[model samples]
Target chain A: MVKTQIRFGILGCAKVGRKMCRALELAPNTTLYAIGSRSIETASRFSSENFLPSSVKLYGSYEAVLDDPEVDAVYMPLPASLHLKWAVLAAEKKKHVLLEKPGASNVSELEKILDACESNGVQFMDATMFMHHPRTLKMEEFLDGERFGRLQYVFSSFSYKASPEFLESDIRMKPDLTAQGAVGDLGWYCIRAILWANNYQLPKTVVANRNPSLNKSGVILSCGSSFYWEDGRVANFYCSYLTDITMDITALGSNGSIRLHDFVVPFQENEAQYFQACNSKFINLSTGCEPARSGELVRADLPQEALMVQEFANLVANKADGLKVGKKWADICRKTQVIVDAVYNSIVRGFEPVEIMS
Target chain B: MVKTQIRFGILGCAKVGRKMCRALELAPNTTLYAIGSRSIETASRFSSENFLPSSVKLYGSYEAVLDDPEVDAVYMPLPASLHLKWAVLAAEKKKHVLLEKPGASNVSELEKILDACESNGVQFMDATMFMHHPRTLKMEEFLDGERFGRLQYVFSSFSYKASPEFLESDIRMKPDLTAQGAVGDLGWYCIRAILWANNYQLPKTVVANRNPSLNKSGVILSCGSSFYWEDGRVANFYCSYLTDITMDITALGSNGSIRLHDFVVPFQENEAQYFQACNSKFINLSTGCEPARSGELVRADLPQEALMVQEFANLVANKADGLKVGKKWADICRKTQVIVDAVYNSIVRGFEPVEIMS
Candidate 1:
């Protein structure tokens, strides 16, 4: 029997990568065939520690994994700082791609990846796993439906609130390392969700404000931005290392609203939540969890192994659209980075309103 | 036997003021002796409507209430826009005062009020009515124990999300009429709680950012403010008329954390909550309102009637120094106004960090 299931290749031993490996191994018909990293020892160690069925192959360099005929797609879990370089390379190698989100550091870099993937026949998906989640889809439906009434306001925050020294030169903290700092890292999801719900249209004006410590490498510690969309939707996006709150989204409309109490992490425990708008009241229907995927399997719980892996397997095996999936990932990356960069620039120029670039 | 209960007079029949009259009637020893407003007809109607006995004098002008010999203290349930004006006037008449929250429009206004109260040897207290409630005291005791370790971060939001026509000159939308917009109205409690918890110390710095909108009086709209205190505790305060959420204060510390869920509204019908703490191992403890207050009250149930009236009764009957109560209230009120003004100044200047002054 010619097995039609797409074989997955793990690239890099990042925390996200290690977690994705577990999911690839679980999905039916999916095969975790190989592991690759810069060092042979690291790749070999990950395969042994994480992958079951020791038959999983280990390769010294990422190129060797791409060369392998057994693996059909690559899961680039490298830092967002390096997503463009590897994603473009994987497409040139004729391998499909599922690059972790904040898909690239900037527009120019993401454009290179998008052009490369289009030139090649293989699929390239920016793994926004969130876009695939059922809850967000339901939220989008309500936002589009008359139930939410005319959309008036949106409030979202996805801040890690890490210290200055947590990762000194980490891409999330340094502008030089990543085109944007906290705004893109934590703020990307917020910006993208707003853009996605409002359609592909752009905002007419963007005013941003930032607070950066002079003691560091001009990395923004806290940033707040207000974007006035072309559709007349005015939004305020806040991301900070200064305030900590749950990751969620609430779309407030004229008559009523819908809130994903855990919009950021949908599969908290294989918890399937659906919304039913009957008459005036909207109800949140949740299926809690099963004994099989309960406890640590919950996204809010430690060891968020299943959710990340399932998204990886779907992208690799499903042949998801590079333009639909990959372009959006890069697009969000750019929009978030542009706004993030604009905010810091506004702060530098004394809180001047900065227009976000395309 | 001398029956000395605090004889109370209320000025203004504002929405919140009518609520205060009810609270005054509930206190054990207090008498709602007189009521005054701008119109004698309105005052008479209020006196009759509230079912006040005919002996409870009705006055044509607020000044008549201030001068009435039977009136021991004045409770001003006027708009935050007029707190300072009435508070000062009441003090000048030697009437002890209970000024409403966001205590004044600016520091200078509150300063003048304090100065007058001091010179006239009168008592004054800002109506942070929540603090006098048992829950606030209970929560503070838990936070102060330091078992949760040093307070790290605080996330608080107070919003109205009311319609555009909420009021023709609603202070929420118009910054000039309200001085600083929602930050003065809603964000006051969040700021007051932080200042109260941290003691009467200055924050090292504060940064603010607000949404763009034309207030009725051309006031600013939504805003975000971050404050860093001398002790390294950080707090983020968000306020808006475009969106409203239940107020929550999550004080995360070094060891564990204590969350005062639903921090603002004192009334929760079936809404019972308690503290539950845990480390890496076993569960610590959990306690909440096994006994619930009737959730029907619209924060209209503040013990202001009992506490403020009792304090006044004590001063008149026991000859206690009005100095301590007056000074603390004055200090809290002045600081809150100063913070509100600083936020507005920062927003006008594009959310620049400013030093809070009182």
Candidate 2:
């Protein structure tokens, strides 16, 4: 039988890479073919530690993975500063790219990688796994349905308390590696949530909250931003490495509202839940509310990461079969990066209101 | 038997006044001594509608209720513009005052009312009924305990869609009657919740979100504000008259989080609930979290409003027995008003960051 599954090569053996490796194995339309690390010994150790099948290849350098004609795609989990270089190189080699979040150091660097993908006619997507979750699809329906009326306010928060060792030495806290720090690493999810709730409509202005917590190296450890639209819509988000693990999203409409506690990742892999209240009102004498909020549970056939991987593989397959390259994922990634850049700009400019240009 | 119960007089027949009338009847330490409206017929109608006992006196004017020597305290449900005048008059007449919220139009006006209450040696408390809920006490304990660790962030929202008639004719939308509009009406509760979560420690600065929805008369219909503290604590709140009814508070600490959907009023009058997650963490591969959040239910023997009235009556009785006036409620009321004032000032100043004075 002729093999039809897309072959995936992973560049780097970072901690997050292990999850993607599992996802590639779980996705139905993808095969985990190769993993490349700076050293062959490191790649070999990662493959064994993760119990990857011996059939999978181990390459000593990222260039070797791109050089292999059998590798159809690459999942890059390199640090943010290196994304521009390796992502462009992978695209130049005509390989589909699934880049980890904080897609690049800034929007300018991200644009370069995007241009390379566009020219090479290969698919490009950031590894925002939640976007592929079935719960997210249900939430989008609720926001679009009449029961929810029109979206007016959105608030999201994503934070996790980092250990003392991680804070002191993690690449995320190093200015040279991840200059955007918490805003890029965590606020990326929050900003994506806000934009998703609004159906990708960019806010007119972005203003950073005053007094974000920063480390000795001047990397943001905790931060937040307020967003305003021309139609009186408003949103705000907070992301931190100094608070408890919490991923929450509350979207309030004109007539209803929806709330989720674990938006970025579910409490469980197979099932996720969200609470919705439609036409809720105060009862007589304003003593209490009518129609208590109802929780909706959504079950997933595959974990969200696997679903994301499958979706990316399908898009790549469709393109190979003469379909137009999918621009949806790329568009979403660019919008998220724009807002992330604006937040950083606002912080650098003393928390001024940074006007977003489109 | 000698009369020991404090006698209460209600100063208006507003919609909210109906709730307080029920509260006064439910409180064991108070008596519904009298009700005053614009006219004797109106007062009589209100008394009948609320099923007040015949022994409750009916007065044609507010001054008549204040002049009644047997009336120990006054619950004023008048509009925001009238609170300063009526509340000060009630206090000057030796009647303890339970003023409805927004407390007054601004902090300056509230200060004047506070001064009158202090000079007359009468107890003063705002009708923020949620503060009296047992659930609030429990939540506070969690916030202050070691499990929750130090507070880092707070987000609150209160909103309700108003009918066309209300938008056109309600005193709350009139500039003269309630100039602060939705910020004063709905934002009051959100600000109070944030302040309460932080133990009434004021933020260092407050900045209003741009483009607040306003009526033709320039009364705010929707608005939000971001608050910052010197120690990197941050909070943001949104309030509106154009969205579905929602009262939510999410307080995040270093190690735990507490969230309540109906923070302003319970979904059920007899019991209130909140959710808390302590020491939650992502499990292996970040597929799921460990120790899911837990829900806590607190039963109330009396409704929150009734509890508020009873607490105020007890303070009045203590003062009557030569105990010094209780200052805690007054202090909280003042702190809430200062933040409220700062929010309005920031809006007026084009969303500038207004420094808050402690």
Q: What TM-score fits each model? A: 0.79, 0.98
User: How high is the CA lDDT of each candidate model?
Assistant: 0.60, 0.92
Residue-wise lDDT of candidate 2 within A1-358, one digit each (tens)?
A: 2235989999999988898988988999999999999999999999999999999999999999999999999999989999999999999999999999988999999999999999999999999999999999998998999999999999999998888998999899899999999999899999999999999999999999988999999999999999999988999999998888889999999988999889988998999999999888788899987777778999999999999999999888888888776588888999999999999999999999999999
User: Could you tell me which 10 consecutive residues in candidate 2 chain B have the lowest summed lDDT?
Assistant: B1-10
Residues B47-159 of candidate 1: C-alpha lDDT, one tens digit per residue: 77767778878888999999887677888877666776777888888887777666677777878888888798777777665556556665566667755455555556554
**Tens digit per residue, CA lDDT, model 1, A260-357:** 32344442334434222212221111001011101111122222234444554555444433323344544554555555555556666865666655
Could you list the iRMS of every candidate?
11.6, 1.1
Task: Supply the global lDDT for candidate 2.
Answer: 0.92
